[model samples]
Target chain A: MFVDFLYELRERGVKVGPQEALTLSQALGKGLHETTLDGFYRVARALCVHREEDLDAFDRAFAHHFRGVPDDALKIAEEVLQWLLDPRSRRELTDEEREILEKLDLEEVRKRLRERLAEQNERHDRGNRWVGTGGTSPHGRGGTHPSGIRVGEGETGGRGAMAISARRRFRDLRSDVTLDTRQIEVALRRLRAYVREGAQDELDLPGTIDATARSAGELEIKLRAPRRSNLRVLLLLDVGGSMDPHSEVCERLFSAAKRATHFKELRTLYFHNCVYGRVYENGSLTRGPRIVDLLRECDRSWKLIVVGDALMAPWELTASNSPWSWTEEDRASGIAWLVALTGHFERSIWLNPEPEAAWYGTAEVIRQVFPMFRLTLDGLTAGIQHLLRGGERSR
Target chain B: MDFARFRGTDAYLTSPELESAVNCALALERPLLVRGEPGTGKTQLAEALARALGLSLIHWPVKSTTKAQDGLYVYDTVQRLYDSRFGDGDVRDIRRYIKLGPLGEAFAARDRRVVLIDEVDKADLEFPNDLLHELDRMRFRVAETGDEVVARERPVVIITSNAEKELPDAFLRRCVFHYIEFPDRELMARIVRVHHPDLGNQLLDQTLGAFYQLRDVQGLRKRPSTSELIDWIAVLRRAGVESVELDDSLPFLGALLKREQDLLAFAEAMHRGRRPRA
Candidate 1:
C-alpha cells in the first residue's frame, strides 16, 4: 500500500521516482511499524514539506489520494504530497489565475522542463532516428533545417532561467484573495435554526358570535411572530447651550440606539431640553404630530428613552417653551405635552448626561414628574444598556 | 509594517493555519467550522474573508429561529402562506420574490462567493444536520420544487461558534475544522495599529496600559475587544481630543464590555489604575 502510495505521488507531479519509492519501502521494513502516528508523520513530513506553506493543502491532497491507507503510511504520504504537490498535478489554470499569477513568469520553468524532456527525447532519438515514412526520420519534416531548428526556437541557452522565470511569475501572480468577513457577521445576525410555530390559541367563539351574531364564527386567534412589546422614544434632546459639554456622548448614544434597537420598534421625537405641545421631526412642527405620532405608531409597543438632562427652569417644564416656539399651541401649557408624552411611551426613562447630583436642581415640576416617568441618571453606556434590557415601569 | 510592500502577502496569509481555512472557503471549495472562545475572531474570520476575497458575502445569521432554509434562503412566511391560500398559484413568480436567504444565495451564486453561517451553536441540533446534506453535496433543494442546485463550486463555508454551546457531531464531520484564539497582546497592539493609525504613541501606551491593568483585576464580566479599542479612539477623535483623559472616558466603556454591570465594574477598576496609592 505504501509503495503504491509513492507511485500516486509521481502521477500527481511529485517527482517520486521508483528508486525513491523503493528506499521508502526499505525504511518502512526496518522498524517503522510500531511508530506513533506523529512519529511517522514527522519523518514523512520532513522529507515532504517544501514551499514552507500550503501544508494543509498537501495534507488534504495526500488524504484524498491515499484515502484508506493505514494511518502511519497515510501520514507519510501526507508529508510527501505537501512537498511534491506544488510543482505538479495541475495541467492548466484559469485565465484569472494565469493573469494574477502572471503567466509569463512560468515561461522559464516550463521552458526548462520542456527542454529537459526534449533533450531526453533527442539524446535517445539520434541513436534511433530511423523512420517509417518511405525512409525518413520523424523529425525530417520534408528535409527542412537539418537539425530541426524548431528546438532552436528561443535564443536562450539554459532555458533554466526561462522555466524558473515562468514558475516564479506564476507563483507571484497568485491573486491576493480571502473570504468575505461581512457575510459571516450578517449570517450570525439573521441566523434561524428551527421552524418554531406556537400552538394555536383557543378561540373565544361565543364572544365573536355576540359581536357578529348574524355572521357566526367571525374572528380567530392566529399564529404570528408574536406581539413583540417593543420600544418608542420621545427624545427631548437638550440640543444646545449647557448640553454642549455632553453633546458627543449624546450623539454616540443615539448611534448605538439606532443600531441596537433592531429587535423592537423605535420612534424618536426631538425637543430642546423641554417639551412643548408640539414635537419636531426634520423641519415640520405641528401640535398633532407630537409624541402622539410615536404613540400611535408604537401602540404601547415601545419604551421611551428621553435623552437630555432635565435641567432647565421650573417654568420650562410648565407652560412656556423657554427656548421659545412661536406657535400658540406649543406655548400654552407645554407641561401638558410633557405629561402626555410620558403616557405615550409604555415606559419612559430619563438618560441624563448630567450626574445624578446635578439633576436635583432641575425645575421643581420636573422633580415631581421625575419618578412618574421612571426617570433615572445613567451615563451613555448604562443608559443604552438600560434601554436594551427594556426600560421598565419603576423598580 | 508597510502592507503594500509585502510582496509575499499570500505566503504570510497561508502561514497562519486559519488563513488556509479561509482560502479553502474562497475556492468555493468546502465548509470550514471554527470552534473558539467568545471573542477569538472565529466569526470575524468569515467577514474578513468576504472582504479580502472580494466575493459577494451572503450572510445567514443563525439563531434559535434559524432553520436550514432560513440559512439557505429567506422564506417570507406571512406572504408565502397568504399567497398559497388565497392566490392559488395565480400570484406573481414567487421564485423571484422568494428572497434568497444568505445560505441559499451562496449556493445560488453564479460567481464565486462566501456564505457565513455564524454561531451555529445558537441554532438547534437539527439545523446542523439539515445543513450537512447541502454542505456535503454542495447543493440545496428549493422549497417550491424538488430541484437540487449544486454550487458552481462549493462556497468557502465558514461556521463559527462562540463555544458557549456545542454543535452536533454530524455538523463537525462535514467541515474542515480550526479553533481560533484571541491574538496575544503583541498581536492585539498590531491590530490596533492596523485599525486606528491616528492615535499617538503616547496615548496608545496609556490606553494599552489601562487595558492590561483592567484585565489583571478580578471578577469583571468583560474585557475590551479589539473592536472596542477602535471605538475608544473614535470617541477621542470625535471629542476633538488628542489624548484619552482618565475622566469622561466611561462612555467608551460600552464598546469594550457586553454587560452593563461589566462597564460599571471596569470603570471602578479604572479609578484604581489612576489612584494606585489609594
Candidate 2:
C-alpha cells in the first residue's frame, strides 16, 4: 500500500524518491496507529510528501489507495481527472443562440432563480430549473443558462455568464510563485513618480560646510526635513489557475508595486481572472471585501493598475457564475463588476500578461471594457504614459 | 507535561486537533512544519510548545539570503588565515575556528531542546532541500576538524512558513504538517480575554465587531490580523478609552488597518455614516 501510494504520487508529479519511500517504510515499521485514516494520513504525509503543492497530489493518491472502495470513488475520480485534464467544458449552443441568451433579461432570470432556490431541496446537476453543472439550467454552471444564473462553472469558454447565483471564496493559491526582480524593476522604473511627501530632520551637509567655513571654523549645523516621494498606487492582481502561468510576471508587478520607493502608498489586492464580487488583501485569500464597498471607500485619486492575462472564458465576464467559485448568489456578471471598478477609479488600466497579438476573441471583449496594455516594458510605459497624459481626465 | 497549566501560563490556546497533531509529531520524532498567515501565531506555537514541553528553545530565523550551511556551523577560515600570517597561537587547531550555529547547536546539545526554524520559506528554494540529510541524520561532519558532530538527543524541530515559497516535497516528507487558520469570533474573544483580561466585555465586543466589519470590506488591500486586534485594544487602553463607539473607533483604526487603502476605506465608511454608500 505504501509503495503503491508513493509510486502513484510520483506519477502525479510529487517527486517521491526511494529514500523517502524507505523512510516511510521504516516509520511504518515503528508502528503508527492506522485504525484512523487521519493517523495514516499524517504519517504518510510526513514520510512521502515534501512540498506544499504536492500535498494535493499526495492526498489524492492516498485517498485512492487507502480509502474503502465505493461506487462514488470512480465517479469522483473521473470528475476530478476531467477537471484537471480540461477545465473548459464543451458548449452545445451555437454562437447566435449564446449571443441571444447574452442579451436576455438577467434581472428576470435572477427573480426566477430565487424562486427555484427556495423550492429546490436536493442537489441537481445538468438539469433545468435547479443549480448544477453541465445542463441547460438557468442557475448552474458549465451548461446553457439563457437569461439564467451560473452556479458553479469552472472553465468558461468565452460564454458570458449572465449572473453568478452562488458566491464562495477561492484562495489565490499561487502565492509562493516568485518572479524575477530584474524585469519588475525595469517595468516599475518607467512608472516612477517622485514628490516630497513629508520632511524629517536631516543635516544639510553642503550648507553646513559652507556656513562653517564662512563663520571662521565656528561649529555650524543646518537641519532640514528630507524630501520623500509621494506616489499612491492601488494594484489589483488576478491569481488562480488561469493566472498561474503568468504568476512570475504578476508577482513581479506586485512586489515592484510594494517595493518601489516612489510609491508612498501601495495597496495590492488579489482576484481570480476578473474582479467579480470581491478581491483578497493577501495571497492566501482568507479575507475579502465586496467590490462595491471598496469602490466607494477607495480614494479616486489613487492610480489603479489591474494585472491579468484577460484570457478567461467569455461567460466568466458576461455570464453569472464567478470565475472564482460556483456558489449560489444574486450577483452581477464579472464584466459588470469590472465596469463599476473602472468607473470608480478613473485612473485605471488593465495590464495584460498575454501578448498583444493574442488579444483576439474574448481578450478583445475584455479590451473593450478595460484599456488593455501588455505587461512588458513598452506596454507598461505606454499605459503609464496614457495615465499621465490625462486619458481619464474627462471622467 | 501539564498542557492545561502551560496553556493558562502562556495564554496560548490550541484546538484539540492542533494539540493532537503537535503531540503526534512529538511522538513520531518528526519536525512539525507549521504554515499560516502572518500574525497567526505559527512562530508563537514553537515558543508555547517549548515552554509546555519544558524544553529550551533554539531559534533559527531564516532570511532570503540565508544559506543552509549557516544553520549548521560557521568555519572561520579567514580568522585561521589571519592567525597563520601573524604566527598566532593555535593556527592549526580547527576547534579554534569552529562555531556551531543554531541547528548545529541543537544537535550538539546534551539535553533535548525545541528548535524553531522561523520563516523557512524566506530562504532559497534549495535551503530546505539541503537540510534533508542533516535533519534526517541529525549529525554532520566538520571537514576542518575531521570530527563528526552527532546529536546526543534529537531536538524537537518546529519549522514555520508564511507560504511565501513552496518547500521541496522531500523536505516536507520528513516533517509533520499543520496549518493555523484565522481564529473565529469565539476564538478571537478567548484570545483577547487571555491577552487583556481587564478589558470590558462591551469594549471587546465592539472592537471585535469593528475588526470583522473592516475585514469583510471588499477590496481591502490588507486585512487586519489577530496581533493587530491586540495592538488596537492596547492603544485604546493607552488612550483611556473605555467604550468602542462606531464613529469613535475610526481614529483607533490605525492600530488595526495597515494598508493605505484599508485606512481610507474605513475613513470613508465612517464619513458615510458607518456603511459604504456604494
Candidate 3:
C-alpha cells in the first residue's frame, strides 16, 4: 500500500523518494487517525523538505499520495494501510484511466475533481493564497485543508482537555516585552486620526475653478500634512552588572520601540553602568570624538526611550567625577551634559520596568534633574498602558 | 505558550524564536541558519527540531578542526569485531550499529530527524563549500549498505554559527538566515519564571536590572546571557543572599561573565559605577 502511495505521488510529479516515504510512514504510525489528511501533512512536512522552492511540490506529493486507494490494496493491508490507500485522483489520470473508473460507476470522481478545480478558482479570486490552490501563504495564513488537523494534539479522547489547557495557557505570548507599547496594528489605528497630512481630498480642483469665475481669475488656498515625526529615536540601554536582571525586558522594550514609531533619527547607544556621556574604545568607556559627534548631530525632535530599571546607586548620578578622567569635560560638565540632553529631547520618554516605590529611595537624584520623562511605574498593566498612550500622544 | 510542546530541557526547550524558526523551516522547506552569541542556543535548534518532530537527533558540534567526514560515518571497530566473533551475524545488522554521525545520521536516518550542524563557524573554511552539494541535494551515500540515501524526506535541518568572523557567500546563498538576539526584559522575565520558579518577583526584577546594567558596560568580553543571569539568581538564592547586595553579587559573577579578561574588565567597571545595593 505504501509502495502504491509513493507510486501515485510520483505519478502526480511529487518527487517522493525512499527517505521521504520513511517519514510519511512514521507520522502515520504516530497516529494518522480520523484526520487522515492532517496526519499526512505532518509526515509530508518532516520528510519532504529539500529547498525553499520545493514546498509546493511536496504538498502536491502529499495530496496525490492520499487521493484514493484501490479495493485490492486494502484487503491485506495494515490499519495504517488505510492511509496508504486512497481514492485514485482523476485530475492527474488520463482520459483512458477516467473511462475505466467510469465503467466502475464512480460518478463522484470527476465531480470531486471539478469541486477541487472550483475551489482552486475560488482561491485565485480570493487573492491566491493556498500553494496548490495557486496562491501564497506568507505568514502561514492561507492553505488548502489537510487530511488531519488534530494529530499534534494527541491520539485520544482528551481532545477537549488538551485544547482547553493549551488555550488556557499561551493566551498572551508577547515576543517582545521591552517598551510595553501597543503592537503596530493596534497603535497604528490609534494614530490614524492624527495622520492629518494624507494628501488633501483630491484638491478641490472644481471648487478652485468655480471660485476663479467669481474672483480675479485666480485662486488662493493652502494645504498641509500636519506635524509628523518622520520620527527620530535614540535608544540608550544600560548594560553590564546593574542591568543584569532586567536585560531581557530591556531587549524586548528596545525591539518594540524600534518597531512602534517611524523615527527620523534612530541612534541606539549602549552605555555601561551609567551614562557618563562617554563612548567606549578598546573596552574602556571614554569620552571620544564619536561621543561629541553623536551629541552634535542630535536635534530636539528625536524621541528617546532609555530602557533601564534606573535604580542607580545615587552617587553615580550625583557625585563629581574628574573631567579629565572622562574626556573633554569635568564631572560637573558630565552632569550638565546629561541634564542638557534631557532638556533637548521634547518628544522623549523613559521606560523603566522598575516600580516607582523601588526608585523612591534609591535614585532620587535622577528624578530631581529629569523627572518629566521617567517611565511612571504604577504596576505592569498601568505602566504599559501609559507607555503606549504616551507613544500615541507623541506620534 | 504551551512549553510542553517544546523539545528539550534547554535551548528550544523554552524559546519562542526557536519555535518560530522550526515552524518556518517545516512550512517553507527552507534550511535555516541561526546565529547568536555563545550559549544563546545556536546548536540547540537542531536538538529541538529532532524532539519536536519526534526523530533521532543527529548533532555535529563543528570544531575549528572538523573534517567533512567527521559528520558522515564512523566505523565502530569494537562492535564490528564483536559481531564478527559472536553470531558471525549478518553484516547488515552491524552496519546499523555503526550509527551515522549527527549530520550523516540525519540524512541516513531510518525515520526523518532534525539534523543540527552546530557551530559551523568552528569548522574549517572549506566546510560549507564541501557541504554545498549534500545540503542542496538533501541526499548522501552510505558505504555500509552500498546505498545512496536520498531525501525520502525525513529530516528537518538547522545550521548554527556564532559569526566569529564571516561565512562564505556560497553558504549565505544556500540557506535562510536569522539572528537570535538576546531576549528583551519581558521575555527575560518569562524565562526567569520558567527556569527559576523559586525566585521571588522583587528579587527577580532586581537581578534582571543588574544584568542589563552589566551589559551597558563596554568592558566585558562577553555579556551575561539570559540563562546565565537566571543561574546567578539561583546561586544567590541558594547562598541565602536575600537582596541584590554587592558582596552576594560578586560571588555569583562567575556564572554571569565569561573570560578572565572580561571579569577583570568587569571588576574595573565596578570601581566608580553604582554598586549593586546602590
Candidate 4:
C-alpha cells in the first residue's frame, strides 16, 4: 500500500525516489504516525514532499489515494473507539502498576500490537487475548494497562482529511505561474560575473607562501582584491497606458533587480510604450535624464534589459511627426532611439510580459531591434543566459 | 541514548503538524529544514526545541559572504603570520590558531545541543550542498591538525531559510522539511493573548478583524506578517485606541504596513470600495 502511494506521488509529478520511500517506512516503523490515518498524512507529507511547490501535487495524490477508508478499516476503527470508551476499564492505577507500565518500552508495546493484529483476524475474535477492550494488554486503549499507547484516538475524520488536503495552500508558490520576487531574484542571479577588482584587502595565501619562499625564509604577507561581481544592469521599464495590465510583473522584476546584490550596479529608468528622447528615473514618468547623456555616461559594458508589452501603433516606433514627441530629438523616430540604445549596449534583450503567440505589430519590430523573450521563468532564464553570452550590437 | 521529545515551550506555540515534523526529524536524526515567510518565527523553533529538551542552543547566523568552510574551522593563517613576525606565542603549533566555528563547537561539545542555521539561503546557492557531508556524518576533519571532531551525541540541527534561493535536491532529500503557515484567527488570538494577556476581547476581535481585512487587500506589495500584527496590537493598546475600523482611516497604519507603496495600495484599495466595511 505504501509503495502504491509512492507510485501515485510520482504519477502526479512529485519527484519522490526510493530513498524517500525508505525514510517513510522507517518513520512508520518507529510508530511516528501513531497508527492513525491523519498521522499518516502528516508524516507522509513531511517525508515525501520537500518543496512547497510540490505540495499541491502531493495533496492531489493524497486525496486520490485515501479518498475514503475501506469498510473493514472503518469497522475496526469503530471497534477500537468502543474499546477506548469502555467505562469499566477506566480504573486508576497504583504507583507500582504505573511504574511497571512505564517500564514497558514503546517499541516493545508496538511489537506486541503487531503480533496481536496478525494473530486475530475475525471481528468475533476480539477478546482479552488480543489487543481488545478491558484487557491487561499494554497496547490497546482504555485497558487496565497504565501508560498503554493509544491506538487511534483524536483521529481527524475522513472528510476532515479530505478538506485539509483540498486546501492546496501552496498553489501560488509553483514556478509555472507568474514570477514572484524571489523567483525573479533567482533568475537574475545568473547575471553575476565575478571579477577581481578594486583595493587589495583579502589575504592571498598562496601568494604569501610564494613570496615568503622567494625572500629566503623571511615572512612576507600578500594581499589581493576580493572577487566581486562586475555585472552592471540598466533596466528600461515601460510604465503607464497599455502597460497597466503588466505593471505587477514589471514591478516584481524591478524590485528583484533593485534588491539583487549580485550586480556591481543596477540603474532603472522608465519610458512609456517606446523609448524616445527621455527616460524617467522614477516610475511616475517625471523627466530625469536625457537618453543621449545616459548612453554616453553608461558605456557598452552595461547590460540593458527592456521590459514592455510592445503593443502600440506602428507610428509610435517610426513616425517622425508624432504628437507624443516632447523634444526636437524625439522627432527622430522611436525605432531610431531604440536602435541607438541597443547598439550602445553590446548585450541587450527585450522581455515582453505578453505571451509569445500574441507578439505581433510593434512587438515584432522591437524584436528586430532587440531580441525579445517572454517574461516567464524559462524566458527570463534564457534571456539572462543570452545576456551572459555577449549578443550582437543591434544596428 | 534516550531522546526527549520536544513539545513547544510556553512562549513559542507550534501547530501539531510542526510538532510532528520536529519529532520526525528527531526520530530520523536528520536536519529539519524550516522555510517560511519572514516574521513567522522560523529561527525561534530551534530555541524553543532547545529549551524544551533542556539543551543549550548554538546559533550560526548565515550571512551573504559566509562560506561552508567557515562553519567548520578557520586556519587563521594571517594571524599565524602576524604571531610569527611579532614573536607572541609559538607559531609552529598550527592548532593553536585554529578557531572552531559554530558547527565545529556543536560537534565537539560533550553534551547534545540544538544548532540553528538561521537564514541559510542568505549565503551562496552552494552553501547548503557544501555542508551535506558534515551534516550527514555529524563529524568534520580539521585540515590543519588532521584531527577529526566527532559528535559525542548528535546535535539537533534546525536550518531555516527564507526561500530566497532554491536548495539543492540532494541536500533537500536528507532533511525533514516543514513550512510554517501563518497563524489562523483562533491561533492568532491565542498567540496575541500570549503576548498581551490583559487585552480586552472586544479590542482584540476588532484588531484581528482589521488586520486580516488589511491582509486581504489586493495588490499589497508585502502582506503584514504575524510579528507586525503583534506590534500593531501593542501600539493600539499603548495608545489606548479603542476601536480599529478598516475604512478611509486606519489608526497606527505604519505599524502594520512598512512600505510606502503598500500604504498607497491599501488606501487605493479602500478608495476602490473593494472592502466596504459595514
| Model number with the top lDDT | 4
Q: What is the interface RMSD of each candidate, in Å?
A: 15.6, 9.1, 25.1, 3.2
Q: Compute the lDDT of residue A214 as modeled in candidate 3.
A: 68
Q: Judging by TM-score against the true structure, name the best candidate.
A: 4
TM-score for candidate 3: 0.38
| Candidate 1 lDDT by residue in tens digits, B1-278 | 11111111321222244543343233224476776556556656666666666666766678876787776665454464455446666445667446767766777778877777888867654577787787878777777655566788467777777654445544553455565555666766666676677667887776776666555656676676656666777776677665544442744655666787776676676676679756
* lDDT (0 to 1) per candidate: 0.50, 0.67, 0.54, 0.78
lDDT of 4 by residue, B89-191 (tens): 9999999999999999999999998999999988976789899999999999998799999999899999999987778778998999898998999999998
A247-359, model 3: which lDDT tens digit per residue? 66665555545544444455677666456656443224433444446667776655555655566665665566733235445455334646766777664445555655666
lDDT of 1 by residue, A1-395 (tens): 34344433433434332233333333333323224453343333323322223245446546766566555655654544543344321112112222344454555556555665465456564422311111221111122212222223322222332343344434433321111122112222231112224554433335434544454533322533333323344444556667777766666545434443233444455666676655666313333354445556565435555667677776666645555556555565556766776666544556666545565755446645543221222133344444444343332
Off by over 4 Å in 2: A1-395, B1-10, B84-88, B246-251, B269-278
Interface RMSD of 4: 3.2
Weakest 10 consecutive residues of candidate 3 chain B by summed lDDT? B1-10
Q: Could you give the DockQ of candidate 4?
A: 0.34
| Two-way TM-score contest, 2 vs 4, winner | 4
Candidate 2 docking category?
Answer: incorrect
Cα lDDT tens digits, model 2, A103-166, are 6465654565455445443334433333444222222333333222112332131232323322
- Give the CAPRI class of candidate 1: incorrect
lDDT of 4 by residue, A1-395 (tens): 55456656866778675468667767776667767777777788889888888888998998998788652333433443443355222112112232243464535544544454454444334434333431221112222122221223322111121122122223323324478776787789888777889999999999998998899878899999999988889999998898898899999998888878888899999988888888898888877788889988898989999999988899989997666678776678889989999889889999999988889988988889999988988889999999988832332
Worst 10 residues of 4 chain A by lDDT: A156-165
All candidates: TM-score of chain A: 0.37, 0.46, 0.43, 0.60
Q: How well does candidate 2 reproduce the true complex, by DockQ?
A: 0.10
